[model samples]
Each structure stands twice: as structure tokens, then as C-alpha cells.
Target: MEYSKDDLIEAKRQIDSTLHKLKETVKTLESKENVSRLKSQITLAKRRIKAFEIANYFLENEIKKDK
Candidate 1:
């Protein structure tokens, strides 16, 4: 499925928000297990954000080429 620019942007925003929340949770957590879980989640979210950024970059380049 293809995502429009706006859709990608929204996805990126949501991912960023989630990442921020996860970081905050990490800071407040006392249990090693819980902190590890949150850290793993944060890592996954960061990877997703990178994926979105790469996708957006390619999409923008494609648009520029089409112009």
C-alpha cells in the first residue's frame, strides 16, 4: 500500500509521541524488567521512525523527479 505525504507525516508524529512517552516511563520505572521492556519498545519505535524517515525521503525524491 502507498502512503501519501500527509499520512507518512502523521505516522511519524505518532511514533515520536509514543517514543517520548516510553522514555518518560523508562525514567520513572524502578523494576529492571519493566525498564528493559520499555527500552525494547523504545528501540522498536526508533527503528520505525527511521523507516518512516527513509520512506519520506524517497517519496520526496520521487516527487521531485516527476516534476
Candidate 2:
């Protein structure tokens, strides 16, 4: 299924929030497993956010080009 603009915006927001929480969790995690998991999730979130930002930028540019 395709995502609407609102959906993308919400997903991006959620990813940002999750990333922030993961960072904090990393700092608080005394266990190696917990730290590792948080780090992995944070990495994934960063990748997702990067992709979204790139897409958003491309879309914005395409809109401008159309005018």
C-alpha cells in the first residue's frame, strides 16, 4: 500500500521519537544486550529518517520544477 503525505510525516515523527528514546536507553543500559539492541534500533531509525528526508527533498524539488 502507498503512504499519504500525512502518513509519511507521522512515520518520520515516530522514528525521530524512537531514535531519541533509544539514545537515552543506551546511556542507561548497564547490560551489554540492552545496549546492543538500542544501538541497532537507533541505527535502523537513522537509516529510515535519512531515506524519508531524501524522498521529501526530491518531492519538494519536483514540485518547484513543475511550476
Candidate 3:
């Protein structure tokens, strides 16, 4: 799926929100397995956010070149 700049920004925002919630959940969780799962999810979210950021940078550069 093609994501517009706004969509990518929104996705990054949502992922950050989720990561914060997961961190809070980790603080309260006792199960090592569950904590590990959340940590993995956090890692995935961070990767996705990085991807979005890179895409956004390229997209913006292209737009500038066009102008």
C-alpha cells in the first residue's frame, strides 16, 4: 500500500503511542515471556518508525526537487 506523507506521519505517531503504553505495561507485568513479547513488539515498532522517517525524508527531498 502506498502511504502519503500524512499517513506515514500518523503511523509513526501511533507507533510511538503504542510503544509508550507497552513500556508502562512492561513495568506492571510479571511474566518473562510476556515482557519479551512486548519488547519484541517495541523493536518492530521502532524499525517501522525508522522506515517511515527515511521514506518521509526521501519524499520531501523529491518534492523539493520538483519545486
TM-score for each candidate, following the candidate numbering: 0.48, 0.47, 0.48
Q: Can you write out model 2's per-residue Cα lDDT over 1-67, one digit (the tens) per residue?
A: 6556666566656655665665565455534555665776656655665665666566555545545
Candidate 3: how large is its RMSD? 6.0
List candidate 1 segments past 4 Å from native.
1-35
- CA lDDT of each prediction against the hidden true structure: 0.61, 0.59, 0.59
Residue 9's lDDT within candidate 2 is: 60
For candidate 1, the 10 contiguous residues with the lowest summed lDDT are 22-31
Q: Quick one: ranking by TM-score, best first?
A: 1, 3, 2
User: Candidate 1 at residue 36, lDDT?
Assistant: 62
Instruction: Flag regions of model 2 displaced more than 4 Å.
Output: 1-35
Off by over 4 Å in 3: 1-36
